[model samples]
Target chain A: MSGASRQPNGSHAGGVPHDDDGVPGPGEMGGIPRGPEAPAPRPPVIHALRDAGLAALVAAGLFVPLVGLRTDVGPAGGGLILRTRWADVAILVALVFTGRLAMNLWSAFRPAKRPRTALRAAQLTRIGTFVAPLFLGFAVLMPLLPWTTRYGLDLGVLVLTYVMLGWGLNIVVGLAGLLDLGYVAFYAVGAYTYALLSTTYGLSFWICLPLAGIFAAFAGVLLGFPVLRLRGDYLAIVTLAFGEIIRVVLLNWVSLTGGPNGISGIPRPSFFGLSFSAGGEPGSFADFFGLEPSPTHRAVFLYYLILVLALLTNWVTIRLRRQPLGRAWEALREDEIACRALGINVTNTKLTAFAIGAMFGGFAGAFFATRQAFVSPESFTFIESAIILAIVVLGGLGSQLGVAIAALVLIGGFEAFRDFEEYRMLVFGAAMVVIMVWRPRGLVSTRRPSVALGERKAISGDLVGEGHG
Target chain B: MSAPILPARNAPILQVRELLMRFGGLTAVNRVSFDAMAGDITAVIGPNGAGKTTVFNLITGFYKPSGGEIVLNGPGGPKPLHATVGHRIAQAGVARTFQNIRLFPGMTVLENLLVAQHNTLQAATFFGIGAAFGLGRYRQAEREAVALARRWLEATRLLDRADDPAGALPYGAQRRLEIARAMCTNPVLLCLDEPAAGLNPRESEELAELIQLIRAQGCSILLIEHDMGVVMRISDRVVVLDHGVKIADGTPAEVRADERVIAAYLGEGDEDDVPAAPVEGAA
Candidate 1:
């Protein structure tokens, strides 16, 4: 019980005391100077130019080697020679200068007031109800559209995979308030499970899917046992180490996992018992349907399959949010001390969150393996974990729609810039910085409570902790 | 498991015997002993750092005593709490509030009470599947839980702000909500640490009335308060502590008359010595 007692400083620290008289603080006064005597003073243009010039210089220095300079081996197996992409450097420098200039102007002229949470909540509700459905409908019809190319289908699959991963991570990090930096480990477990089971035992995709989720959940439980007492950054660091351990094990375990060569020619999921193969056995999808074989059929089927799984994940998560366990998860987030005082078993609550979140990651990983028809340690890297985490953060933690939107904007946007090659990551990094600055909490920061007693007003994210459990 | 043992009638609901707790070289609670009778309001009063909270932490299983036993007398005789954890102690029918209010600030006022009844609803929810499916058993439990929460809210005069976040309530109201939340566990014994610490005069008066009401509703109360007025008016028995040791224990009038109790509060100086009767009235 002494161990069960909350960390003494944990609960009460950083709590904003409620003022009985309802007088707003200086920062909450709509950002307008009250009882002001002085007129507004804008920054001088020369100052703005100086700030922009500094930004340009820094940008030039950073990009000159990474983007501006490239080393190339001489044509025939000769010594290396320097190759410069001056155009790339100039484009980057100009972008930085213009961005800095705009920021300076906006800082000087933009309204001092923070946007009203009420107005933002209303706008989000409108978009959530109207625009969100339209986007979902477009996703549903994406493969069926007349103009869809194979490349578009492939990109769609990639985007959806990350979307599912982001949503899965959201359950642990966003909803449960556990900062897991090693979520990709569970994804790897699921992928490897499918790879090993289907290839060795000749299990079908349907049979192995549930097994993958279970195995990943077991891994989650194993990780949960030793780390239940840790909180915040300590918990995050352990999870990150766990992720790396899983990756390294998968890399070196050659006998079972095929070493670095990876498990390949992993079978694709069939349309029920009907294979999507062309030469068409009696049970092949095309022969059974009495149609000519087409590669698009399998691609479209895979799209629909993943769509159902992702949607099911979303549906189950939304339902879990209202349950006692879900409330316990959130309560644990708000105050673990209070939660224990309320007679909650902290260990059980945390384990459930980790296991469930990891379960979804497992399902997504299995889908990924089947889609690619390969399983490799290379795919489950720390950067992949970082990207999925970015989606959750950029979307607003604990937000379902936000995660989806973030995945689309980040993963989809990255794919859209594929032609930029090395420059794409540069743009990607810049866009991430800009978006974070624009919305620090996230793109959709307002929280919609799972249950409400009366009118369900969305709460401002300001009141919520930054995912502490 | 062994056979269940029944307790004698009219026995004390809680017993702390020879409790000893040491932190390094310092003994925070040393050889303390007390029996809080059923259906009675017992108050523990002391100077700052007299280990009043440390004692509460011991009984509620926040800390394991270095030496001693805390037993809760249930229908099945005394249950030793030395082996129990905080949540288990709560399940064994002892509940308490912190000296600093520990309400879930993010949760609505009513939700705070609902969380306190987590074990009951959690059982009905069948590990969350029943709740997810909105089964009749889960819904019924939820209805009863909400009803109980509303009832307590009404008693605490917090019904009007039931949907407001508990953290947004005034300091006094947050204290009341914390008490209400602890009561929602439906414990046989309720231990409150400094329940009147930050309350205004009117709020303290109302709190005195609420304590009586809760006691009348069949829950025994053990309170720790620095406010002598509330302690004297509401408490049927008083236990005084000084420097982690019990100094006095008796009826309010009896403890008020103890010379050691007077000396503990006042100075040990000879000139400050006075008859305890006038001091009680003055305090």
Candidate 2:
């Protein structure tokens, strides 16, 4: 859109697309009120050629220094000398020129996309309905594969952890329409809760897990109080501040959090009081079950633990959508003023959304602490919150299955390209830009009503409110 | 004794006394006062920007009055609506429609109705947790809620499209759905702002019938309308406001004849012959 806007107005002619306000005839667009779908007056094939040529020229100019030339050490002890690689520059320019030309022509000639409607959205979601169960089944059985490696199990646990976090934040951002940039704060709370309890009080992970969620929920309520009246960007800014506040507090609160050094050697969760040691101790998991000793046992157990937790989050979220409170949250998102007229306590609804979302974050945090046996303020940064938010938004806000898939792709994608760590952010950024351009609403953008008296239909994404809150 | 279906007819449902609202230097509604009796349609007729909606806002608790009070005479007796907050006004048995339609557009039509009765289910579900666990009691409450929603959907003629998103409903249907959604809150007083604004004559006639039907159900109607044809025919009583002042309050016929009310309308509408609409058995 920005590129389209930047072009000289008359240059668009008939070939360029405008927003579909009713279709306008071709020649009227240059001067009259223009729509993106205005009919082409002329072929504009010449304009396309000019635009593509110009783009290629710019690409060549940029590539001349960036790719066409390289510097090498001149002799062992001396300065550098220039090496020309015009072949590389020519290939890059040719690719850019053709790519730009193809994109321009495709966009120009393509029929206008159909307006989203409930029936169409329902048809799109039918595909997801079929695919989701198959994906869930695959996830459940993947750990049981005969060639499953310990690294693979750990990666599964990691991806599942993000999936849980994404599901939790979905309640706040997607369902309630509250954009929370501070979700990772709750995760930090849960991790620190387990870390401090297990390291200080010698409490088991089982006991500390619930406490972590409770504490995080408590923190959620605390954050919810002063910001109850804020909405939209104001709400987002406050939540962002809240996230930074938690991180800074942890960084400075030396006596309790150990400052920047971080707490380590946090105890791993036991399998119902059975340790995972290979010492053949009586309480060891292998000893109790009379199985051969292998460290894979602990990894597999951790994988299953997080898997169960993630599934529980998904299940509870699905159930809550049918509940009155959940419906109110959605209503509030659609129109807060209307919610007020309908006699919904906006304060209570927003608070519950925050608290519940934070509780899940806390649960995930405890899992993180137990798995890594380490806790640090550095682990709970704004980046973690951004990544989690990206997953929710990219997954189509409230879509449960979409969130799971997005989490898997994002977290697994990050780990899979570990060899190219330097370019990881670059690839991620490009992917985000491409996703935003292609599908602004998200990958799966249908919203199924929590309860329906008639046959259920998926509401089109355009109808759903991007909650001001 | 066989009971009358209407509850306590002719009792005062809403009373406004010296209702005032000010935005900065402008006094939107100044010293407006009126009473709507139960089982009656009270149409508030006024010129544009004459503070009709300002008065409705004060009564619905959307805006805190600069001065004066609005009261709803609930079954429990007169409760001060002006003192309560927004949702509290609805909880106190007062509900309103926006001048611009404000439905939960993303939700299905049935879901919009269900949201209107949120207070009941919220309590039944123990504020959201019990229902999450599939509690037994909430399921029954939910069934009752759905039944109630279906009844209203049937009333509004939206039953066939219950599963469609509210945003997709035709404009006239959306207006009817807004009224239905408001009634789902079970308010004694329903305040409608310009309910028939964009309706064609046929649709407006249907709206008049719906309003009367609502009145027959024993709920008081407080309406702000620009369509004089619908206003004069359906309202049992009409209160005229011009520039934030009530110029006349009486039966629709009386108010129509009042010279002051006619002058306020700037003689735009011939006040005398609106009643020819819905003439029975006319050839």
Candidate 3:
């Protein structure tokens, strides 16, 4: 009412408008105006995507091959021009351009609809769109195509596993705003849980999956207790140490984990009774089912399995965010002092975030072990945690869709460039630096902060509140 | 106004018995004792660094007392109120606002009030998964929170800006929102630190009316304010602190006329020389 009437143009009451440098200044931007209705500024995404598009075009030109080159495929009777190297280079350029274009379109259109529904649909569609290509390329198209298709499908599966891992980490780092550097510890817990359970009990992957999540949740609580009082960089260091400790335990504890040699011959997931292997019964899946027995079937199934798990993770995360616990986490992140004032048990809030986040990590880890049919300390390294954290950060902290988009670009795009092994990490690192410089908050930086109660209408003079919890 | 809702014969709602707080060699609150009745406006007044805020902090569990006890007369009568930290104190029925408005800068005004009721919301049933789908008793708690927030928003005349960030509200509105947020917990005793610190005279008078309204609702108030006009206008009783010691405790007129209280303010040579105007720079 009276307060609303006193609000500055495009500025919330008590909120001083800042220049590009973030300094508050006096002007129409900071002065109280005499009006009943003043339109709020457009959301930040539109501006970000426009800037990203211009940068993408300039980067695309750098990927053009120096010499127009070609290779021949002997399998086809005719000379099939092999532009593998140029195509590989061109794909990166194309990805950047596509990512920019997609971001621009998303930003421009996002504000036209209800933010909550649009956000949910955008999240699902983004994941769905990326996943549709995998099912088509791996399951249906690969078998009909050539050997090159098989290789591409295998690489896609591998990239997807990491993407899932990154997504799980995103729930912790992105949504909860907890800096977890030892996320791989949960991954190790899941892998080991499955490996030990399947080998010792002779249980199937399906049965071990839920158990792994529970065990990892237990482990997360264990880690959370000691670091309850810690915050910021200290918490990060302790979590990093915890990750290393898990790796060291796996490596040195030979009796349980098989130590340095690592656990081998880990069983892959089976469909009901059928297994993907040679020398099965005469009328097995290949004969009785009337389908060709190929390793690709296992790869395709695993890809879809992880894909579903990833979707579940996203769904669960979105839902949890609307809950009281989610708000508590954001509140804690904003100000522990105020959170305590609200009678929120900060210790318990943090533990829940850790436990839930780790549980998802465990699910991904179990899937990883079954897919690869192997378990090793090498897979659960600090670098893995770093990459997952990077995905969360690059996507944007506290933004679920942002993390997924980040993973798709970073993990998917990086793996797609496997042929250029030496330059791959260099390119990834450079891209990260460039992204950080351009958009310090990350690519998809707009956050739909966890609102206490339900989402309310945007009142005049107020920009969207950040959810510290 | 309405008749004061006095506590039952034998016990005060909150009784601080010889509470003492020390910072190394420096004694912040020295043997301060007070009682807040069930429904009364008890104003705590003091010169700068006179341990008024420190006493509030000690009572609200922001700081542990170096000595003495804080007892909230529960159903059992004179039960020790565990003043462990800020959060536990809030759980124990004591809510407070900072001298500097400390609303979650990123959170909306309505959310600021809702967060104050966080502990009252039931936990997630069905292994925390049910919360994701928004299926739970939390819906009822949410309704209560919204209704309470709306009531305070209307009371503060901030209903139109309910969805705005608390930090985005005007300075006076921010001050009122802080009180609204504290009230959402349905606190037995509201501890407000310098609620009138930076308000204009008109806003201060409005704040005084709001405090009286809050008291009329059966809530006991412990306020630290520098505004003499507001203090005299609303406070039923006043406690004056000087150099970590209670210099005077009586009705507002009695404390105002106390020579010791007047000397404590005027005798503090350099402090009195400084401008008596409100400090307006934002935190």
Judging by TM-score, tell me the better candidate of 1 and 2.
2
Candidate 1, residues A119-170, lDDT tens digits: the string is 5545556556665677789989999899999989988888888889998998
Task: Please give, for residues A142-179, the per-residue lDDT of candidate 3 as tens digits.
Answer: 43465646667776666566667777776667655678
lDDT of 2 by residue, A1-469 (tens): 0001111111111311112335566878678755478565566576777888999999999999999889999877599999999999999999998898888888778898776554554455555666777877877887899887778888899999999999999999999999999999999999999999999999999999999999999999999998999989999999999999999999999999999988999998899889998676788999999998888888989989999999898888888888888889899899999999999999989999999999999999999999888889999999999999999999888889888888988998898778888998889788878887787987777677777664566677899998998
Best by DockQ: 2
Q: In model 2, state the lDDT of residue A114.
A: 74
RMSD, one per candidate, in order: 7.7, 8.3, 10.9
Comparing 1 and 3 by TM-score, which wins? 1
lDDT of 3 by residue, B66-178 (tens): 88889865333454653466677787667888887778766677777777777766343343555556664666656766787889888887877766666666788888888
Q: If you assessed candidate 2 against the hidden native complex, which CAPRI class would it receive?
A: acceptable
Provide the DockQ value for model 2.
Answer: 0.38
Q: DockQ for model 3?
A: 0.31
Q: Chain A TM-score for model 2, please?
A: 0.84
DockQ each? 0.32, 0.38, 0.31
Give me the displacement of residue A287 in model 3, in angstroms.
5.0
RMSD of 1: 7.7
- Per-residue alpha-carbon lDDT of model 2 for B167-271, expressed as tens digits? 977777888999999999888888998888776677788889999888777788999887778887889899999888889999988987788877777374765
